[model samples]
Target: MTGSGHISAFSARRAALFALLSGAFLACLALLVSPPPVPEMKSSAIPPPLRADRQVEPSFVHHFGRKHDEATWFKSDFYYPNSGHPAWQADLIHFKKNRVELEVRRRKVAYKNIAGAEYQRRGFYHYGRYEVVMRAAPGSGTVSAMFTHTHGQFGDPHDEIDIEFLGKDLTKMHANYFTNGREHGGIYIPLGFDASKEVHLYAFEWEPGAIRWYVDDRLVHTATPADMAIPQAPGRLMVHLWSGTRDQFNWHGEPTFRNGARARFYCLSYQAAGDDTEQCSDSYTPRKYRR
Candidate 1:
């Protein structure tokens, strides 16, 4: 081959080698100049749905006696002291310990069917979680219930939430909540404490969208808004304790017919709706607390 031909071949080989080296150098630069490897990011986990709020410790909000100026009222409308047909004319007796005791008898009495039924025009209802501490009477054919619910008294679309203790076994507490007059809730939890035997704290917190029932310090049941429409807006707040009934609970497998059974003693504590929010965050000790 001519000298010029030889030079041209060598030039082509050099050009190819230079291109290969440039590519290799670029790869090396990428390995050194790029950002350090990002360790795989770990994500936190979340809780499940339809669960009650966590169990909170015992607390007491201010509870004052009847105030004439205040429109809110919490008076026991019916008291039956003896074993006669239930009527609305029984008297409430005062105890030496400054606690009020009412005689709830087991007798026949006609009650309004409205879930909106009101007591003294003051709508009585409870939507937040509530815990009732009391000792109940023992025996079969006897049904006792403490209600913290919404009734039709104020308006339509009524709701009701109940915590009941039947005869003989106060250790087992039942919880039920209603929405628009339908049975949308149910739970059976061990109080770990007794009802007829001794006095223990029984509570259920009905939050904005859930309900958590408690006994003393133990969390018995947790309910969700999907089950019932609780913490309803503009609903009444009520606290009721009765030993007998002809209501829906009986037909639905509840032990009804409380005969002369008495709710020995009871007290309710709750937070009042503060000025800033429509919810309450206080405790109520009977005749002992003030807002």
Candidate 2:
């Protein structure tokens, strides 16, 4: 009887150990499959908002037909070495066949250097409605973005509003805003359709009190000052297509460069605050807002 009791106790101990190990293994698997956590806004990270006075009668529209107006648009010819990824090359930007093509090509070089393209409008824009009609690139590790950015120009704090598509999942649109180099709001809106498969209208209206993001003219998300201080610094409208590094695989999946990637921009427009009419219009119909 003593020996039998000891055997039963030993079996129970072994069973408990197995249960613990199984639970831990499942937890690790869940983490590996789950999406990365969206960063929370911290008050300590917020910077004092800059003053953005409404510009008077600021408006412009560009339809990418043959060539971008050199007087108003600048194709970036610069690269960031410290970014440890792709370098912006003017040759990768193409204006042909009625659209602006931002291409990303893998390079046979040391340290993962790739070629990418970026186009930025000259000068800065204040509070306004910004719109872009474009198709995102499709490939793991690539990012197709349309955003307003002021990278601390002239000593102003870094402020930005972003609309980004992670090539790993073109069905999800990522929206984020940064103030003084600190990220405040980050979200993923599940687009009902693949953004890379077709051209769609994406827009954001930035005001003093709120920033509203729209997909096909349907309001998808709204960020108020209560969530975080609204971005105030004037920023230049820009678009780029670039790839992520290996270390960023968790956020953007590993890149496969067999065929390369390209993002197409059909049109871009901006309407300054208090403007009554859009600078240009497209044939796309507005969809009803959905949460």
Please tell me which predicted candidate would have the highest lDDT against the true structure: 2
Compared with the true structure, model 1 gives a TM-score of 0.54
Tens digits of per-residue lDDT, candidate 2, 114-232, equal 77888887677878888988889888888899998876433567889999998778899999998778787559999999998878899999998899999988899999888888988
Clashing residue pairs in candidate 2, if any?
Answer: none
Once fitted onto the true fold, the runs of candidate 2 whose alpha carbons sit more than 4 angstroms away are 1-57, 108-112, 279-282, 285-291
Runs of candidate 1 exceeding 4 Å displacement: 1-86, 90-98, 106-129, 243-260, 272-291
Q: Candidate 1 residues 1-291, lDDT tens each?
A: 999999999999999999999999999999998855533312211111111332222223322233321243434334323322134322332232422333445433344211111122133333444445455656543445656544343234556667777664566777887777777744766766666667666666666678777765567677786665664543444333343334544522343434344554345555332322221123323333211
Q: Report the error of model 1 at residue 189, Å.
A: 1.2
TM-score of each: 0.54, 0.75
CA lDDT scores, all candidates in order? 0.47, 0.77
lDDT of 1: 0.47
Each model's total of backbone clashes: 31, 0
